[model samples]
Target: MPAHDLGPTDPAVTVPEITASVPTGPPPAWAVLQRRLFDELDGAWRTFRDRYTEPDGRLRFRGTIDDRDGADDFYEAFFNWPALYRLGGADDLLPAVKLHWEAVTRQLTELGLFHHEFERGYDWFHQGEALLMFYGICAADPADQRFRERAIRFAEQYLPQSPTGNYAPRIKAIRAPHNGSDGPRPGLGPQWDDRFGGEQSTMRPYGLPLHDVPGVAEWNDLADEELAVRMGHHMRDRLGRGDTAVNLAVTALVVNAWLYDHDPRLASWVREYVDAWRERSHAAGAMPDNVGLSGTVGEYHDGRWFGGHYGWTWPHGVHSVGAAALVGAISAGIVEGDADRLDLARRPLDQVWEQRRTGLPSDPEATRRPGWAHTLGPGDGPPVNTLPTRLGLDGWFDHQPAQVAYWTWLWWFGMRQEDRARLEALRDHSGYDWTVVHAFRDKEEAGHEPPWLAYLDGVNPDYPEQALRMALAQVAHRTALMAADEKGADGKRTHETGADDGLDLHKWQRLNPVVTEVLTQLTTGAPQTLYNGGLPLARVRYDDLDAARPGLPPDVAALVEHLDANGTTVELVNLGSSRTRRLRLLAGGFGEHLITTVHWNAAGGAYPGDSRDHHLPAGDEVARSAPVQDNTIHLTLPPGRRIRIRLDMRLNARQFAHHTSPTTSRRP
Candidate 1:
């Protein structure tokens, strides 16, 4: 009567092989609450090293994660790797990062970019997404000669001086520099030429509004000028233009990554794109998911926004959150940039905050899906599965939580006071990381069938199976579509809808590939996910390991705090009129953090670069972070009496099973 293997490892169910030594120990309660983030990061690297590779350094993937074969896989993997050496000193991920970098280049065709279908030559958005991801990971550790070299190498290729790419010759082309599989047509050179329906992608691919925006008017009247200048116009006719979650989100990643490496051009290009979109946001008040190229909105007679997988709906909002976050992150007073960019990015966040003041961020007005409508709830909350966020952003087509969380977490940094507090309460990524991993691991360890199966059957009303099923079904549908090949009447690649909600082999592809792509998933079997923000969570602490910075002066309050890629970011607020010369932070209970070296975030320009020994009349600069003999970090308050610090973690001895005194009974 049950659906199927609701348990772990049913011979009947097919799942991508996950091969890693699942550390099975009922670790001490204190230990259980602490994550060796570095350890888990290392384990993840080892997992990749052990499971995803061949002896010859060839990475393999046939629709499974660690496939590392396509642009999507590359970006996802890069997003997760290199914690120690880059931020601390493990250096373990450096070699693997370098090898993957070289292998990715092999996928590059004449377009000088990477995508799922190598033969297709290029997927402009993903090309930049992966490039930026690679650059971020590699540059995290400037001391790594190989990482620095590889980062530079990728920069040269991606931001080529040669005019043989799909990128616009100007400063603000969203299309990546890519060409078709056959290189170029007989007469045209390497640049993308005017052609339709070959491998050329359409620009202004934003989430389209399904309904009309009444007051919004298309303001830009410069198409005639754009045509004359001839920059970034896809060889197609364009009366209207807009952006998508894929383009804007990945563009944010590109801009930030470029800044990480100190490149002003790519960052400037990203600023230009945001500037265009910001103008539209200003006109409309509400930032539509997409807009015209001339930095105008409400243009298309059809709708206010454009349409795609990230169509002016859930996916659009999900993707847009990333770009929004960067606006604030850059304005976090960390970088010297105009405050306007932060405000532009925060436009949507401000909306979310207003909605939070009223109800949830979810559009109560949404008819199709209420869940997907909410951009992000809280980290303590479930994965934001109001609906599935698609990734046609990747050429082959897939979805994953890491992408969702990456955007969400970064956006968390941008949240204003009320919003940041709400977001911080849910910091552990309950939906994606904690909820899913908890259900999977707890049940598996107890030797029960998949616990979620009972929940799906309506037996366990309290379990968060809906979110889990949404994620699982996503992967299942993708895998089903992968195995089943559909061809249209004319033999173009197509897909079908299965009765069981799985991807079937015979349906006519929808006119909009994005629509068909969405249909296949809502209609498919057990889903798949390449990487989960929650997957590593089993190894992470379910409990808040470190309490609020203890022993703060009565006048000082721990204002805002969360872990960045390298360490903990704490912003101390001074509520009292008088300034405390020094605030001693009780740094215990953090799993491995008690031993990390401390540095003023403001002192260090960026992350890894900031992790170096600090000695500017602040805390003592250890050559490397170590186990603290005393569990407190002393800090000198700045002129404003407010300060932010980075407690950068470094690798030490393997973490013991019991970090705290043993009498604490284990409970997650």
Candidate 2:
């Protein structure tokens, strides 16, 4: 069934007035930690803003991105600020986020990296990295006309009639592996030395996209200028042009526009583009990473399905492919309101899993062994769920334990039995406890889903407090790093450094203090969005009705305790000593869920004047219910009171949008 159909649609369904019990105890440990985390986050962001940004909110990077390497890094620094604001970070944080985005865009444009306010012909992986900030801004304040215009304009770049000419409708594919506002760039930039540094440090890791370059037997041969030029020419001829799997990420861009504008053309284009990839994945057996201009898989690699830009052979193989496939599948599902669209991603994942091995080979040099595993299982113990990470002409190699990054998303989007079973099976074979929290952070600043899922399963009861503390520790660590930088507290020499000096291209991400993965998962019941360009989806989002801002009101903290296909259970607590708080809860990030019934506990008898002082009678567990067929619930949380409510919801019931609130000034 279409997910939207699960919502209650009848107008005549009667709803009753409901109130929550006036609980008379100290707030839960998680609630206290949540409030404390928010307070620390506010200070941490202010410190980061002061040290890393100029007065105008521009990054302090003295070096310019004369090429495509640093734009994503620049934008990634502040990508989660808007998300922080949406989760009730300080109000000033939103304006700063906007300023940073504007400043970064202008900075990149001046450096010749961007045109039409978007990246100019870069891989979707980086493009997706750069756009996360833009997407968060829209989610935080969707009514901003500037964001609306940019969303629509950027989405248009991938359409059949795009002014940038990114799409070749004749072949039903994007024209090149690198694409953006400048459309499909003809080839890699001519300044090869500057592009990858004089020694080509970045390119050496991937070896070469194609092995049979006329005279190159080994990567070290490319150290010569002449051989390097030949390699460049071959990469330009074979790797630069063609639709790679990474291009599937464009579906998210188009889907964002449709969410804002409800344009039929935008929706149609997403379905068309995604469906084209869907057809190709099936025909090729395991989704081919590259398709030639003529629309044939492996047309450039002598009929091999794996070797393409950011495909199975080079860089991250199934990892990148799986991320892009998830985006395409989720976008298609959002457009159609059907979970079945997830098959676009599911099939490819299954195909990769079919090639799974028991463990790594005993011989050290037998394959391109990435590394020994430690996170999922003991490093020295027997390997568990060793799946291929990359594949080439020799065969599948680069093996490691399975990653739950995209599977977590698949389960969140579909909420189907099969996805649940698959996740459980993967967990059973993981050879590690699911509830253990790791301190390591990825580019997305996530990867704690196993523990989070355990919490939701009622096993890891302490995850909320543990994760919040983890977030606090991370912020403190990053803040200390920022203060200790050689550029000093103010980052005075940041702009003076050149990229050639090994100026830490990912410095921003490493030092960014804003951490939202724990808050997002616990409060919103959604996974950390795919950092490389996926929508910030949620089961519920909030607004501070009392403060007229886009987060929990002062002294208010929320926790979504349970989530499933049919309903959600959330606890709202007002920790203030006196002032009552009003909160507006929207079902789904874009008001896409229909909250059919709100069930809560209220005082059984009438309140004696002030409800906050009323001690509930013994065993007075009076439950109340209200039939709510819309997407919002206006909550009045009194001081010293906490309420836990189960919201019977139909996921993806309404047209997605940046909806305006009936009370707050938040606009549609």
Best lDDT among the predictions, by candidate number: 2
Candidate 2, residues 350-389: lDDT per residue as tens digits? Answer: 7667787676433243233332233443345555566777
Worst 10 residues of 2 by lDDT: 8-17
Q: Which candidate has the highest TM-score of all? A: 2
Model 2 misplacement above 4 A: 1-18, 191-198, 214-217, 224-226, 358-382, 486-501, 605-619, 661-668
- Residue range with the least summed lDDT across 10 consecutive positions in model 1: 510-519
| Per-residue alpha-carbon lDDT of candidate 1 for residues 1-668, written as tens digits (9 for 90 to 100) | 11111111123322121111111112222111112222333443454444334444434332221211244434344443432232222344556665655564463332233333232333333333344335435334334555555444333332424233423334333332123232211211223233212122222232212212222122121133433123212322232123232344334333333433446665554555556556656776755554333333433323444332233342344344444334323422122222335555555544443332122233333332322222232333433323323222211111222223332333333324544443443333324322222311110011111222233233543333233333334334433443344344566443222223233211211110111111111111111111211111111111111211112333333421344334444444443334433433433122212324554423322222254656323332222222332223444443234454555533111111112211221111
Q: Residue 161 lDDT in model 1?
A: 47
Please state the error at residue 38 of candidate 1 in Å.
Answer: 5.6
In candidate 2, position 237 carries an lDDT of: 79
Candidate 1: stretches off by over 4 Å? 1-47, 61-70, 74-78, 84-91, 107-133, 144-245, 250-267, 291-303, 306-317, 320-340, 350-415, 421-668
Cα deviation of 353, candidate 2, in Å: 1.5
